[model samples]
Target: MVRLFILLAAVQLVLFVLALISCLSAARVRNAPRLVWVLVILLIPLLGPLAYFLWGRPLPAPEEGTVPRRRRAPSAPDDDPDFLRSVDTEQSRREREALAQWEKELENGEPDKPQGSA
Candidate 1:
């Protein structure tokens, strides 16, 4: 009976050590508070491990060969007003330059000059 008790105690001790180590390791990987993890492992020894197993593992990244589905890029109208304004200003500048060149050519009557009549 004493031998059986000793064996059971040894098994419990090993499990507790494993749980503590795993909790510490997982907490380190997860960037969680070490003191909180230590307390959890010590206080709710069995449930702590179960909780970590269910929630601690990082979600898998998308596979290397898989093509991500096409999605529209998010526009930050309010958050990035300056960026939108810059784009708008650039487009306006191009339009103005094009119009100016066209008006200058028209004023010079270049298009009205007979084409292919050298």
Candidate 2:
């Protein structure tokens, strides 16, 4: 039917325009050169755009002046400054607790037991 033909033509036109715009606006193309993509889109309508969408468009590259993210290196507790400080504080607290326990024992006239005995 004439209406069917018109609809098909309109679809083709829309596809061609979308492909052209995408090809032009893309920062980088993959699998083929830009010129080749342009020619393909112009000469072969549907398949060209399909191919482009599937494989020709490259993943977006990091913008200029932006550093690519990197994973931090795993560090030991001793190697990390923050971890070392936390460990130091914990050790001091334990020492204070032990000292307080010993002072209490002395006040009660209880002799200190050997550490290994407990």
Tens-digit lDDT track of model 2 for 1-118: 9999999889888888888899999987988899999899888878888788788877777899998777665476667877888889999999999999999999999898888885
Query: Candidate 2: which pairs clash?
Result: none
Residue-by-residue lDDT tens digits, candidate 1, 1-107: 99998997776667668767776655253435666666766787566655544554334567899976566555766557677889899999999999998899999
Residue 48 lDDT in model 2?
83
Each candidate: how many clashes?
A: 0, 0
lDDT, candidate 2, at 19: 82
Name the best candidate (by TM-score). 2
lDDT of each: 0.68, 0.86
Mark the regions of model 2 whose C-alpha exceeds 4 Å error after superposition: 60-118
